[model samples]
Target: MADKPTVTIIGLGSMGQALASAYLEAGHRTTVWNRTPAKADDLVARGATRAATVSDAVWASDLVVLCVLDYAAVDELLAPNADVLKDRVVVNLTNGRPDQARRTGEWATAQGAEYLDGGIMAIPSMIGTPEAFILYSGSRTAFERYEAALRVLAEPKFVGTDAGLAALNDLALLSGMYGTLAGARHATALVGPERAAEFTTSLLIPWLQAMANILAPSSAEREAGDREAGDLPSEESPLDMQAAGLANIIEASRSAGVGVDLLTHLLTPMRDIIAAGEGDVLTDLVEVIGKEIRS
Candidate 1:
């Protein structure tokens, strides 16, 4: 391998462009390809090579990076070029699920490609900066080999050898993000459209940020609610407040004619758990979720 590796990038969207820039800045020889050639102009202007086709890009580099829309797009773009994929390290920074990652990894293995699934935890602006964190899973050697070039996207966190780990954690963090937005939507709707943005910027934003710190404490308390988990009994069980308050909030939203169906749906499973007499189980809410708590 040369002192600075050569990199080929597919998917020239905002995130892809950012990655390309980062790699170019780090002095890697960058070969870029986009579904539409126009998008590669800026990178080309910056001394990068623009490939006419996906196979050309893949064949030109030791590492082929993908930062496309999703796994579906990935499958569409690369599936036709399976013959060209042999003996290459394919790093997918596309968003997907654990199952998708594992399935895709298997497919890549069939093509004689070493697959590395990655989840980008940062927005486009943070790419290559210290603020971004990227999760990688698959071959440890692949992670180590491309660590320097990959650091352009974020701090590379090798999430173990499981190809599914990257996509799984990606889904996990997205759940929290969606939940936070869901709560924001609920709060903003409860307050009026005119006041919603103001409330989010002022009240709701800080409140949710506060939840970050208090959440760990309440998390423990929630776990204790599960008698099977042997939680210490407390006079003030949080379930009463949760069930009743959420019920009331939904009721209020209904009374005001605001659409709160989503929040109601999210809490429904939790409500069902509590009704099933798991009210004391703090972590019982995890059952409604798609993954276990990060803890």
Candidate 2:
């Protein structure tokens, strides 16, 4: 049989460990390192090598994957070892902002390392499963070279050449998730604890799935700058009507002894769009919200 590729994993947190485990399962020779060395005990026991220092880990393999806690932690760990990283492919899957990823990519490039910034869209438990999809950007050459190895960890998505693209897309997707969760929390609170689970499983999930169908086409329209094209305003929900309904939601939540904070926050943009008399196209609120953000 052909030999498997070698991979070094830095950071032995839950996600980091999962990454290492997946590489090992895929028959790769794995080297692992963590600030807390004891955290790597299990991996070492599973036939993986343990590196005593960050430089040792970097030198152990050409393909290095970092799943550290944050960009700050990544800097602290790798900043002093630039010399060891030369000609190496460093894939950083740390959760961070786009600017941070861009800065890190620049630093890595200066040190002669090929860098790929990644956003992991799954929890640790989902690593190595089809459900996990990893978004990567920067250093297309490095990505292509290591694509086979990366696929063992998750479904690999090469987003763009800009190092910040992955982080930007990651944060955007997360923002949507958090916004949806905030609305769900308010809904559950209004319904009370006893029926919250049932409501979510029975009503919210199916309703949101159907709403997702609308959002998919709406997003395409927004991207094409043709807000009037898809599912016209006459057939769609109106902003004035949505704002009025939000007011009712806020009032109802307060009456039910739950906080109206989330619903009230949502109403701000709707009110802004309504006052500007742009309520004719409900989706135009996206532009209104973006303008508010820029201001």
Worst 10 residues of 2 by lDDT: 226-235
lDDT of each: 0.83, 0.88
Estimate the TM-score of every prediction.
0.85, 0.92
Clashing pairs in 2: none
Give the runs in model 1 whose Cα sits over 4 Å from its true position.
Answer: 217-237, 266-271, 288-295
lDDT of 2 by residue, 189-243 (tens): 8999999999999999998877666654566677887654334334477778878
Model 2: residues >4 Å from true position, as ranges?
Answer: 218-235
lDDT of 1 by residue, 1-295 (tens): 3587799999999899999998888888999999999999999999999999998999999999999998899999889999998989999999988999999999998999999999999889988777889999998888898787787668999988999998888888888888888778878878999998788898888988776654444555566653333333334556546667778888899998888777676576677666777654444455555322321
**Total clashes in model 1, counting residue pairs 3 or more apart in sequence or in different chains:** 8
Evaluated at residue 32, the lDDT of candidate 2 is: 99
